[model samples]
Target: MKPQAHPTLILWVLASLLMLAGCASPSLEDYRNRQPVLVPDQFFTGELSARGVVKDFSGEVIRTFDADISASWTDEGVGTLDEVFRFDDGEVQTRTWTLTPVAEGYRAEAGDVVEPGLMQWQGNAIHMNYVLRVPYGDGTLDVRMDDWMYLVTPDTLINETTMSKWGIDVGEIVLVIQKK
Candidate 1:
């Protein structure tokens, strides 16, 4: 005869499993059947404009900006997205992303990105994760960026990016991009 397991122990284990399940992040597959169906090559073409805000960890809006973007694809299918941002504090910045199509999605690279990010889309949503180096107090800090974009219309897209460091949420960016 085998000894029975403790009821309290069984309940604690089940509760721990439930908590872990709740912590799981969303996957691109989860949005596979969503609407609008975003195609990067088609939607990110031509001239575009964006307006957005940056929020700190406490959810306070720290900055805002307007940007202009020019996107084009090469004959070989490589794409370029040139962005120029004008901040409310009278500062200007620029970042250009090179996108190369791959089997799963696109490989996205920028000057400030520590590594190429995998940009994948299903239905109307696109997701990308990358590490970015940003200016800090004296030098710079590398932060993880999780980007999600949704195409609401043929000409409009909404983007949200969460910035984290050391597995802790640090900031967020929310923006809208529209074709011009």
Candidate 2:
């Protein structure tokens, strides 16, 4: 008689496949070359407000915060975004992003950014990949971050950030920013 595959093994294989399929990550190449209607310098100009949450690898919410931001075009295609962040635990911090137009798209520099960040957009989504120096204990952790921004409307933008360390998923940040 021919040997048969065990039922439990078959079920495990199916479950693993389903989980992998459901966990597919977003790719910029999926939307490349499609002209996105996003004008970052224009859409982010004036006053803005944002609310966001930080979640751990298992998707448990770790923290939440809000922010008030001011954005303006500085000179030529260069822009500045000033943000003041207030955390739920009563901690506050500030970050400034200097955005300069580049040949590919834009280059962003900030205090915690290890290197100049690169940005690319297609369709309604903008992708920014960078290494962020996150405060950990007394020092800082250099984490790879993939930040994606989707324009929902003229005044509304939703951003999602995935953070990883050593090629392993660490956490995520989800934010909704709106023009004021």
Candidate 3:
């Protein structure tokens, strides 16, 4: 007698095939086409700004900073970025970033530092990430940043960020920016 086929095994194989098919990467052109329309004479101007709490090691907001970020990208994925951060108690910082296309996304550089940065359209969100120098012990410390910007409308973005180092929770911030 021939061996009988197992229905459960068949179903599991089918599901695995479907999952692999869904893992294909999106084309770079698809990325550009899907991006929100951000231009000058607008509110956001591809610029970023936010006012939110800056938390401490104790999970408390030890301070606050009002941040302003402006960036522009070229058609070929090469662009310049300007970010300004200010504290409520009188402190100011400015950073410039250079963005260039890499394997699938872009690499972000500030001064002599290099870090991974990504720009992607997931559902309706355009997310970005970078590293910043934070006041650690006797010198500046490197912290990973997960910066998120969501489009509530065609020209409006809602941003919230989380900063962390040593895999420890640091703080959270919220900001609103517009275009035209």
Listed per candidate, the RMSD to the true structure in angstroms reads 5.5, 5.4, 9.4
**Residues 89-160 of candidate 2: C-alpha lDDT, one tens digit per residue:** 998989999988989988999999997788877777889989999889999899999899988787888999
Clashing pairs in 2: none
TM-score of each candidate? 0.87, 0.82, 0.62
How do all the candidates rank in terms of TM-score, highest first?
1, 2, 3
- Model 2, C-alpha of 98: deviation from truth (Å): 0.7
Identify the leading candidate in terms of TM-score: 1
Q: Name the runs in model 1 displaced over 4 angstroms.
A: 1-23
lDDT of 1 by residue, 1-180 (tens): 999999999999988986786479778788888878899999999999999999999999999999999999999889999999999999898999999989989999999999779999998999999999998999999999999999999899999999999767899999999999
Candidate number of the best lDDT: 1
Clashes of 1: 0
Q: Tell me model 3's lDDT, rounded to 2 decimals.
A: 0.65
lDDT of 3 at 128: 66
Q: Over the stretch 23-64, how does candidate 3's per-residue lDDT look in tens digits?
A: 662333343444564322233347666666676656677778
Candidate 3, position 104, lDDT? 45
